[model samples]
Target: MNFREFASKNVHRNIKAYFAYFFSSSISAALLFSFTMIIFHPDFVKVDLPQYLIKALNVTTIIAYLFLFFFVFYSVSVFLKSRYKEFGILYIIGASRKQIQRMISIENIIISSVSAIVGIIVGIVFSKILLAASGKLLGFNALGFYMPVKAMIITFVAFVMIGIVISIFCSFIIKEDMVLKLLKGTKKPKAEPKASSILVIICITLLTVGYYLSITSSTKTLTNRIIPVTLMVVVATYLLFSQLSVFTIKLLKKNRNLYMKKTTVLWVSNLLYKIKDNTRMFFLITITSTIALTSIGSVYAYWRDKEDQINRDFPQAFFLSDIYDNKSKVDSKAGFIEDSLINQGIEYNKINEELKFVIPDGGKDNVVIIKEDIYKKLISMLSLNANFSKEDESLISNHKVKNIVLDNVEIEVVLKSDRGLIPTFYGEVYVVKNDIYEKITGVRGYFGAFNVENYQDTLNICNDYYNNFGYEKEDKYHNNLLKSRILRSTKVAYGVILFSAIFIGLIFFVTTGSFLYNKCYMDVIEDKKKYRQLNKIGLTYKEIKRVLNIEIGVLFLLPYIIAVIHFFFAISSLRYAFKLEIKVAAFRVIVIMLIAQIIYFLIIKKRYLLEIKKSLI
Candidate 1:
């Protein structure tokens, strides 16, 4: 047979071994292609995405491409390692090193080309669905699909280049002196896997410290400590698998009772070697899955709680603010707003207050002072309660300030409230009795807070009022309608972010599963031989199946369990940081990911058992 035919036949013969890698590569290509199509779509520009969002999309697309390169390279390296014996036999049969390289290059080319083409085809088929989903997430009505020639070309070229680059790199992996070791394969006895006691202690300490930091940190300190905590946990996780796991397995083996239990000896004996060999793989899977879970959970939580957050920040349907000197202008704008609400058949309560902006004694910042009557009226409208006994005693509406001294008139701050009576644009605000308010002298401003029924349904009227009066280069009047618009846009931005994160996170998740499957399948031949011997020793197929279940379950679930633990800590930290009630959203994401992992595990387990069962026949 010619060289091309031989290489093609090799691929066809080992299709089972190559399937996972090929499938993963195709998925990577498809995802990248889909992202590219979205980026280059005509409707994307029409949506007027924020500049940061556009930049984020570009950055994520680049990151995905880089990840694809590394994934392809890693898979190819593992494939070559698994075929070391095959390559060693070829060498004995007089196949030159140059000829083998050529064979590998040909095989990779075929795989890459087919994978790229198939991926593009899949991408094209799913383009409409992808576009529709993206549109809905971005708050656009439709992102019509057109011929994605550019996307196809880019994805095709990118994967093809990845294949070529990885194939060339694979040449260096097959070193000249490795032939002897390759031929020896599992025949060579391996020394007992060792772990450093000091490293194990460090790993435990790091994990403890990391978890403690994440769990105990308050919202104020979380940002400052998040990086250090993350680094600690990540390093600890790697050590946990690489050192702690091996060390623990050794300790377990020392317990004769546990180690010698029914079938425990079989799986336990194999597990030590497997864990030692797959330490890095387990680490990679844990870290990647942790990242995926955390990202999706955080984004999902934020998206779910966005509306409540908006309501907390903006309690009223409309707020009109103007300088004290522009009293007439403020009244005119307020009248126009009230008129617009009436025209829209909306019922509303208007609380008009004169606010005094004063700097406290020895303080550079301005504090807004409002009369007790106005404060009570505004709070009552919003269904909130507060009491003031004396004029000297003041309630600070702003959470940050404790007390205020204006013109040497000291006012005792009695209560701090989370609910802002006014838009946060006015820095610090205090509610005092009329007697105290009259004494404070500074720039006076007109502030109006309007509470309306079903404020969300008033966007049209709010827009109209804003366009007529508030929309100007030098317009000093500000309204809550603008805040609502901002909140809407913010939701869209977050939706885009959430969608992107989920896409990237799923890719990471799927890649990790494929990596595990590849690793498991690579060991099948050795497992077959080992199990064959066990079978001859009167180990029934049922017993063997039970042993395989334990082994494979550990291989699949260990990293996932570790990742889930990491995700719990991560979600906890997120809850503290944002102070949002996001447990429901986070729980939903975790359950979804858990279900997906279980499904993936079942599919892989079934396939693996079939492969092993082939040995019995």
Candidate 2:
């Protein structure tokens, strides 16, 4: 047979080993293609996305492509390693190295061609849904669907090139002298896997330190320590699976009652080698899954709490101020805004307060002072309760100071309110009696607060007022419309991040599952042989099945459970760092991930059982 035909037959015979690799490659291609289609869409420009957002999409697409290359490369290495015995037999039959290289090239080309074609088709099918979701999340007009010829060409070419490059690189990995080693393969008996006591202790220490730092570090320190903490956790996790797990398993083996029970002896004896062999795979899976969970959870938390954040920063729906002494300008702008609201048929309450900016005695910073009457009116307008009975005392709003000396008048701060009476731009407001305000000589300004029902729905009117009357020059008349716009834009940006995180997290999850499946597939021949021998020794089929269940369950769930533990600490640290109530969002993500893992486990377990059953027949 020709080399092409031989390669095709070999691929067909090893389809099980190739399936996960093909599936993951196709998925990676589809993700890239779908993202490219969004970037290249005809209406994308019309969406008016900010330049930074556009750049972010482009950068994310590039990163995805890079990830795809590494993912494909790793899968190819795994696939090649699993077929060492086959390669050895070909060597024994006198197949030249160059000829084997050509065979591998032909096989990869076939797989790549089919995967790219199928992936592009699937991407096209899902492009419209992705566009609609993006548009909705970004608050843009619905994106129209068109043939993505440029995207298709790019994705197909990229996938095929990646396959070819990786295949050639993998070909060079096999050496001439490795034929005997390849032939031995898994048949070479292994001594008991050993763990270094020092390494195990180091692993435990690193993990403890990492977890402690993650949980205890405040937001201020988190940024500086994040890199070191991540490195620590990553190295610790690697050693955790490589050394700690083996050590723990050995300790379990020493318990004769637990280790010697039922089919435990069979599975336990086999599990030691399995865990040792799969250490790196477990490490990769755990880290990848932890990243997926934490990213999705953190971003979702930000998106979920966006409204509360806006409300906290901006208490008033509309605030217009003239930092200069221009009462006429402030009144005119305030009247114009009130008229605009009336024109839009929106109900609102307005508070006009005169604020005096004075550098407090013995302090360099300016403190705003307003009268008691205005303070009462402002709090009532905002549905806040405050009592200021003494003229000598003051109420501090959104400030931590307990006393203020304005123009040498020592005013004790009787109450401190967290809620801002106005937008936070005018800092450190003190509510004093009219006598106290009149006694201070300082630069004065007019502040207007407009509280409207369903104010969020008034973006159009607010934008119109700003367009017609808002001044660009600073220190003249500043309005809160810009702040409102920023808040809306912030929400959109967070939505974009949250959506992207979910998408990338799913890709990571799927890749990790595929990795596990490939690992299981690699051991199928060995498992079948081992189980057949156990069956000859009067081990019943039921017992063998039980052992398989135990082994498969540990293989599939151990990494996931560890990843969840890692994720919990990560999310907890994020919560403390950001001071966000992210428990609900984190919990939701965990539940969804758990369900997906369970489904993946069931499917893989069934397939593995069928593969091993073939040996019995």
Candidate 3:
């Protein structure tokens, strides 16, 4: 037969083995194509989004393309490794090394071409839905659907390049291995694995240190420690599976009761060897699971914290400062704003506040002082029932630090006032009694905080007010406009990240599942001998099934459990660092991931038993 025909037949015959690689490559290409389509979408460009965000999307698309190359290449390599025996058999049957290489290359080309075509088609169909959703999130009035020929061409070319790269890579891999090693494949038996106490200790130390750093680092200090902490955690995670797990399992094996039990002995013996051999793959699974959890959790947390974030960044819809000194100006501006709001039939509530800045001897600067009565009035107006005694000092700050506190108040100012007077020292707001505030010789100002029924409508009124009389006081709608602008940018950024995280997470998940499946399949050849021996010793099919269940279950769940532990600490750090209320988001991420993992485990288990049962029979 011609090599092309042989390659085609081989590919068809080994469809199950190729399923994971093909699906992953195709899905990755689809994601890349979809994202590229967004970047070059004709309607997307016509939207009123920022150029920088568009630029960011372009950069992300490029990065995604680069990432997919490595990802697809890795899956292909794994798939090739699984078929080493096939190549060896061909060689033994008088097929030259070049023939084998050619066959593999032809197979890759055919598979990749088909996968890429399917991927691009799927991506094109989904890009419209993605763009429509993104448009709504970005506050775009319209992002009409149209085919992006440029994006399609880019995706097609990039994936084709990847296919070529994989083909070349496979050739090199084949050339490096001896014919005997290829024939033996991954089934070369070795002595039982021994745990390294030093490695176990190092793993424990690293994990402890990493978890400590993650949990204890404050919001301000986290960024500095993040890299080192991540490195330590990654190294530790590898060792945890590779060394610590082996050590612990060995210790458990020493227990006669658990070790000598019917199927436990069968599974445990297999598991001991399997765990040692599969450590690296287990580490990969754990890391990817952690990535999926953390990425999805972070995205959900940001979305969940949106309201608080808005309030923290933009305290009020409109803020009028230093209006006390000029009553006429204050009356004019406030009257115009209220009149405009009334004219537009927009509902809003207004608060009159007297703000004072105290020049403190030490601590922080930019501190605003307000009378306790005003504080109580604000609390009452907000329907908050918190009590503040005359002696107790209340602070309003975005950050929570030592010597800092929070009240239900939001203050904004710097050392320099609009009148160009520089305060000697200012810090956080101090809600003090009227007597203490009066004694401080503080710089006083009129502060008006406006809350609108409709944020956009109120922002429009504030903008109109700014255009009329409050232009000099840019602080009013600076926060509003800044808030709107930031929200738009954040929606886009988070939307992109969320979609990417979910897509990539699913890829990693599927890839990991496939890894486990491939490992099981590889073990099948070796396991046949072991099962034959067990059957001679009267090991029943029921017992064999139980062993297979335990084996696959442990292999599947160990990494997942470790990853969940890692995510726990990670989300904890995010909570403390960003001061985010992430319980709901965390809960959602955990539940969804658990459901997905269960489904994947069930599928793998069913297939694995079917394969192993053949050996048992």
> Where in model 3 is the C-alpha error above 4 Å?
38-63, 89-97, 124-145, 148-151, 320-336, 351-365, 371-427, 433-448, 454-493, 615-617
> How do all models score by TM-score?
0.91, 0.89, 0.83
lDDT of 1 by residue, 116-152 (tens): 8998999999888999988877767768979989989
Residue runs of model 2 more than 4 Å from their true location after superposition: 325-335, 354-373, 387-414, 424-446, 469-479, 482-484
User: Is 1 or 3 the stronger prediction by lDDT?
Assistant: 1
lDDT of 2 at 550: 86
- Return the lDDT, model 1, position 243: 94
Local accuracy of candidate 3 as per-residue lDDT tens digits, 507-554: 567667767766766676677777778888998878887887788888
- lDDT for model 2: 0.82
Give the winner by TM-score: 2 or 3: 2
Q: Any idea what lDDT model 1 has?
A: 0.82
Candidate number achieving the greatest lDDT relative to the actual structure:
1
Model 1 Cα shift for residue 77 (angstroms): 0.6
User: How would the candidate models be sorted by TM-score, starting from the highest?
Assistant: 1, 2, 3
